[model samples]
Target: MTTCATELLDKLASRRAIVAVIGLGYVGLPLIRAVAESGLTAIGIDTDPTKIEMLKAGRNYLKHTGGEWIAPLVEAGRLRPTGDFATLAEADVIVICVPTPLTRHMQPDLSYVEATARSIAPHLAPGRLVVLESTTWPGTTTEVLKPILETSGLSCGRDFFVAFSPERADPGNAEYDATGRIPKVIGGDGAEAREAACAFYGLFVERIVPVENAATAEAVKLFENIFRSVNIALVNELKVVYRAMGIDIWQVIEAAKTKPFGFMPFYPGPGLGGHCIPIDPYYLSWKAKEFDVRSQFVELAGEINSAMPRWVVDRLAEALDRSAGTGLSRAHVLVVGIAYKKNVDDTRESPALRLIELLESRGARTSFHDPWAPVIPPTREHAALGGRRSVPLDPATIADYDAVLIVTDHDNVDWSALAEARLVVDTRNRAEREGLAGPRLVKL
Candidate 1:
């Protein structure tokens, strides 16, 4: 190991290293918390002034992560949030947790990751270890990030170290919310880089699984999410087939899950949601074409999952026509739960937004009710749906809509109230599970 690498490792071991985490979204916020709680000084950097202002004031913007805990951390000087990129010079270890979204053509979009690298490159100093926690294609760590970062005139393994440690953050999942409990997978540019990363993360994270190189670590994240995308696509396809055969897909899943081995349940819903499962598979598929190989199986899964929102709307339209003698045209439809999944405020790549758009395109008056997301925020694809507020879910509000479509089954939603509605199209099988199933209730 070089002298610079030895010094960095020593700082990390004593928890004296200043850890700077870029981007203050879901993944970054939890990581900074873990670092601060582990007795290390955590510097949070984001371009958004609002996030920095809130953090400085000790107020938490994210609902899943409470506000009360943030005050003490800021008060204790263990955590410092800022919008300045120049602060990277003071950081001994920097972790990039920016967004890794897809382009409109479904290609990998590394703009956020690239921009973050450029922003900090000028401030990057020798002996500082830069780790990327953003999810992207396999070669991103070496091919993309490393080249851009080298613009600082610092040679990668010898001067400044580089590593890839993909963030596995599941927002709204209480069981997995604790960052220290989750096992972190790390891959580095070289042995020294890997050693520096593992040593830093060992301060906070409970377990560290180090891989051979950065590319493998990048593949690990894509594979983990694609596994979910494919399995979900399978159950989603089964939902359609069994629905056509007049068999209840929910009941079939319940019975099939009783087996001790070779059975794990993945439920069908309006469509794929959240950051990873919807986008990461396409990242893999896009990368596969570079090697003259087509990821047809993964691409096929993406197709099935993408089509779910429209299929759910079609079922809702059919239910309205059969039960109320009216179609979606001029019908008042209420969409329950706009957040991608239950109990989370995050609406990134949520299928419910598409369902609302589809309903309105067919001339239905659409409204949504989500306890988590009170008002829809601006999204890249669903910009038109932004600024819309969640409607009340009381009995009076429920009776006004001609048909109630349940896309996301939130635990806080009152499923029993749908019994008074004229029609209930349950995509999540929430109504039946709540003991309110009847002829007017349709399950998809």
Candidate 2:
């Protein structure tokens, strides 16, 4: 039997193994940069030819990729983002960072991960280490992914190696680099696979926690994101109830965070946004149903977070109804911040998108002002309004709009500019700025 510790040490010392990273998106792109920066040349594989061209031209599509750094790095020959799969046969260490986004029903969509594995399987060889970093259900690595890899008459842990190492990268956090911000959790088929997986991540991560099998590693990522989804939902629920009681949920949370033990705070938002929190929980919920278990917290959190758009719309309607000289039908609402969260440009599954739609449906004319996202695309209720780019932080324009809604609290927004507005709906609790705050603020 292959020993985990021995296998890992051998792979690293051999540095002759070509590093291959599949799926060059938010996660894969950063990882490719890290692998290249680590003094080893890695092959970045992506199906999107445009993305490949962007990489070749030294332009990264992700908002977090910071064109300043990636541009110079790609100028060198350390990384090559290619559309070829034949590179898989040349890899010693292969990390799969494909998307595990939810389907229309919020079910685990493994088509990319599974299909990628099948495609790479034909070229998979002995002594190659395979690690999956995509957020997924618990048994995906050992069950769904392994079957596909073994389809080429190759056995896992025997003929080759397989493991799961859940990626915990916070896309927008400048402090959390791919190499060291968080410790990596690794699990595999057995002791050997576990060690090999640990050794591989040990090269970049601060530390590694090895478990008995790949399922455990997969579960770790799901549980971490699910915790955030539930806590945020809890606050979202509390925000509504507390508003009725005339107590600010944000105030209560800030006070409750003082308890040293058993308490960590997750702020309330318009909805759970981004690729992880909104999608990872559903992976568990979908898998739970297969085993006759109902993940109630996950389901409830999902339902509550998803419904926040409607609630925000209702609140915007109420804001307009209560306004002094205008009706909801004629009110011009300016939503500040459209990205999923503050300081990040990524808007995948952003709650602000839904909120914008809800506002427009009620006859409230809406324009967004996001420093990151210049243009707002149409969703369920909004038409494709051309040139609806983010407006500059001008108090005159703020005064022109009847109401200014704070959907996302990105860093650069000048809250003071909107202080003189006739109405303001503060959803992300971001109206407070160093020189900003006035009587016009309405906490939602």
Per-residue lDDT of candidate 2, residues 149-245 (tens digit): 8897978877778888887778667787555557878888877777777766666667778887899888888899999999889999999999999
Candidate 2: regions farther than 4 A off: 1-8, 71-76, 377-388, 433-439
lDDT of 1: 0.90
- Score residue 155 of candidate 1 by CA lDDT: 95
- Candidate 1 TM-score, true structure as reference: 0.98
Clashing pairs for predicted structure model 2, backbone only? 4-192
Query: What is the lDDT, from 0 to 100, of the residue 210 in candidate 2?
Result: 86
Note the Cα lDDT for every prediction shown: 0.90, 0.80
Model 1 lDDT per residue over 125-226, tens place: 889999999999998988988899899999999999899999888887789889988999999999999999999999989999999999999999989998
Best by lDDT: 1
Instruction: Estimate TM-scores for all models.
Output: 0.98, 0.94
C-alpha RMSD values across all candidates? 1.0, 2.4
